[model samples]
Target: MLIGEVSQRCGVSTRMLRHYDALGLVKPTGRTSNGYREYSADDIRRLFHVECLRTLGLSLNEAKRALDEPDFAPSELVGELIGHTRARIAAEAELLRKLERVDAAAPAQWADVMGIVTLLRALESESGARRQQAVLSQNEGASLPVEALAAAALSEHDPNVAGALRWSLARAAGEGLTDLAIGLDSAVVEVRRRATVAIAAVPTAEATVLLRRALDDGDVMVRSRAALALGSRHVADAIPVLLGMVVEGRSDVEAAEVLGVLAEVAAAADVIVLAMQDKLDNTDDAPTRLRITQALAEIPGVAARGVLAELADDGDRTIAATASAIAHTLDRRKRQGFRN
Candidate 1:
């Protein structure tokens, strides 16, 4: 077959076939008297082989060596090609993510688009300061996708950066609530803690409801935070978790204070007092009993007073002493109030 016929028959362009010949990658087997390049069957087969190698991302030199050298091992070259392909795929995926984030921002101008891109890049910076600054400026550009803030907050390590990220998410509120809610279920303890903190600050009814659900999370840290937030919001659902915190000695003092607040705000002081008394009856540990006795001072009203009076007679010396002191304090406050 001549060059043109070969081009049609093999589907390799005449120009490309000539270029391959020049590079000694593929040479026609013979030339006709008319000075046209003539390809034999063997030459046609080589051209087909070169095209096949090119399809596998082989460079012309590599493809030529593969066909010309009988001992050429494809294993090493194939491994290299796989590595290159993986790198390209990763690069392409990163680009796609950037585009999606930019589109989510809905930038009004080229400058806004660039700014959002810069902020997004800085959020991933190795410097904690840069990451915090990026989050603080998260609201400056076009609205970023809530997923961006959620992703940043979940992975942030530096205390300052994590606080800033949580604050930013809370301020953004409805924008990222769903994504932050999902982070509440993260396998990483720190991420779940951050999610709870961020969601706690969100001032929405939906956010409150989300935090209430977190009260049942397996992580004590998650449940404690959610319980505290709900307690402050007068959500009586936090009662069980708060009592558990007192019993487990995790943030027991703060839990007591929040429980007091919940009791006062919701007028559930009797209920709170009853729960404390139940724990007092079941618990045999001296220190846990001490914590519970101290926690009682935080609760208000006559019901808490009666519990304190009964605790004052307990067999434990420290428990009896603390309860006596708290009972006197509450009695003194009551007298002072009546005098005023």
Candidate 2:
């Protein structure tokens, strides 16, 4: 087939095909007497494989390695690529969360009109320079151009523009953008809120300090957001505060959510283990006990395994099932590690 036929069939532009040829990615099977490129069936098949790899986000160089090395398993490479993509997504998600809070805090008038315009303007400016910086904070590693574009989009005030920016930000977060969580200004309430949500999505040591400060805010809303954000960091130091809220505070639902977040961040088995122990021993609230057990499962560490084993024998079938599942996962991980 000629270049045009291949481009039309494969959905790749002729320019891209030419570039691929230049890079020795997919050479023509032969050349016409007139010096035009001619692709054989094998060349077309190779082009398809290249296209697939590109779709998977592999750089040409990376894809070339996979193609050239017959023993190279695309599955393994794809798994690694997926991990990278997830990190980027997480970071971008964090950015979207921050933007959402910005939108929420903006005056209602802005929501109706000029607000989106302002956001778009801000995003456009950032998109030019700070995009990479923002995305780099996430684990996914954002490039300068992409980050700049995203920041520019985010700074716009037009609701449509802001919405698009938000979408891009969310995608960047899903790709594991973590940069926005760093060096946040706690003095600004909106900034704090955005930081809180972003930190919750991707908890870090620095975020713990910010969250702790927010938890101490005089405003209940600030305190709630802070407490909720602490879920991602899973800092044991915050446990006493979280426990107090759950036991004495009016917002039981919020407290429960905090517990759930803590469970995700918990490294020490006893923190959640002891919380579950307390809830089980003193609280006749079957529902609450079940909730605590579920949270306990979120902690992933060796200590959790022991606690889970103990809980598996609990009288409550629901708790027992959760504990059994956790124990099974831990055991499987251990076995896999041993084999490795």
Top TM-score: which candidate number? 1
Which parts of model 2 have CA positions greater than 4 angstroms off? 1-208, 217-221, 228-234, 240-268, 301-303
In model 2, state the lDDT of residue 140. Answer: 33
> If candidate 2 were superposed on the true structure by all CA atoms, what would the RMSD be?
23.3
Candidate 1 local lDDT, 132-209, one digit each (tens): 888787554346656777778877779899888777777775678888888887788888898898888888899998
How do the residues 1-340 of candidate 2 rate in per-residue lDDT, one tens digit apiece?
A: 9999999998989999999999999999898899989999999999999888889899998888889987887788889899999999998997786566445434355433343434333443535333333322333332222343333342334444444434445554333233444324446555445544444443345546656766766555556666666654566556655655555544655665666566665454457657656766787665666665655555565565666678799888987888798678767887999999
On lDDT, the leading prediction is 1
Model 1 root mean square deviation, Cα atoms: 2.6
Give the local distance difference test score of model 2: 0.61
Candidate 1, position 253, lDDT = 93
